[model samples]
Target: MATITLTVNQAIRELSDIDPTTPLLWVLRDHLGLVGTKFGCGKGLCGSCTVHLEGVAVRSCTMPLASVAGRSVTTIEGLAGEGDELHPLQESWIEQDVPQCGYCQAGQIMSAAALLNGNAKPSDDDIDTAMSGNICRCGTYQRIRKAIRAAAEKGGAA
Candidate 1:
């Protein structure tokens, strides 16, 4: 067991006595109770467990708690406006009707947020390339792309 400290959703968390090899997905969902990050393949192939490791998108299921020692992690629950205002992407997602089953939405949103952070005015190809890893069984790719573009244009993210 190892003690690890990390910044999650801008809050510092100190976890004492935990297996280092345990996947971050379990730590977030099981320990911290941040269930927004879904469990999909439980492997690196699926991006359902995507989260931001120091502002970079990564698969939490394959990442061990030991590796994220002092990094800032952002989950779906953390990606939003200050309060009930709703993030631009969140609003655009709803406006565009981007969710089907909603199982993959958290990963989708996390991936999209990363993309927008780097490239605010991403083209269709950029969106395609950045979001390619996330798999949505509902196949709402077109709508997802549209919502991203809309959010970018509407100044949804600063």
Candidate 2:
């Protein structure tokens, strides 16, 4: 057991006396009380555990706590702007009716946020490629794409 420190959602967090090899998913969900990053397919294949590591999308389930030491991590809870203002993509999501079951929406939104961070105006192909890793059993791919495009138009990427 050891201590590890990292930035989470712009806040410095220190985890003590924990196994460094533990998956970051557990640390975020169980230890840190951030349940927005869900658990699905324990393996890294499913994007349900997606979060941002240094502004890049990553699967928290397979990412070791040690790997995130001294790194910046962003979970769905941090996706919103200050004062709990919804990110543009989030507003677009509601406008587009993107979620059905909503179980996968957080990860889906996180992945979309990363894409928008890099490409303010992404093509349909780009959206498809960036979102291919995430799976929505509700089959809301079309809505997802539309939401991304709408958010881009609203300067969500900026």
Candidate 3:
């Protein structure tokens, strides 16, 4: 057990007495009370536990807590702007009606946000390639693609 410090959602957070080998997903959900990142497959294949590490998409479930020490992590709750403002992808998501079961939407959105952050205007193939890791059991792939394109049109998830 040791103390690990990291920044989350633009805020500095310190976790004490935590095993460094502990998965970041549990630390975020259980310790930090951020439940937006879900648990799908513990092995990290499903992409349901996706989050951002230094503005890059990462699977949190298999990421060790120590790996995030001194780094910045962003969850779904932090993807928005100041005071009720939504991210472009979030707005496009709602406009496109992208959620069905909604269980995977948070991860889906996080993945989309990362893609749009890097690629201002991604082609259909680009969107597919970037989002292929995230699985939406509800089969909302078309809507997801549409939302991503919509957000891209709105200036690339700024």
Clash number by candidate, in order: 0, 0, 0
Candidate 2 worst ten-residue window by lDDT: 149-158
Top candidate by lDDT: 2
Tens-place lDDT per residue, model 3, 1-158, is: 99999999999999999999999999999999999899998897878899999999999999999999999999999999999999999999899999998988899999989998898999999999999999988899999999999899989676
lDDT of 2 by residue, 15-134 (tens): 999999999999999999999999988898879999999999999999999999999999999999899689999999999999999999999999999999999999999999999999
Residue 108, model 3, lDDT: 91
lDDT of 1 at 20: 84
Per-residue lDDT of candidate 1, residues 1-158 (tens digit): 98999999999999999998889999999999999999999978879999988778899999999999898999989888687777789999999999999999999989998998888899899999989999999999999999999999987563
Instruction: Give the total clashing residue pairs for model 2.
Output: 0
Clash pairs for candidate 3: none
For candidate 1, the 10 contiguous residues with the lowest summed lDDT are 79-88
Sort the predicted structures by TM-score, highest score first: 3, 2, 1
RMSD of 1: 0.9
The better candidate by TM-score, 1 or 2, is: 2
TM-scores for every candidate against the unseen true structure: 0.97, 0.98, 0.98
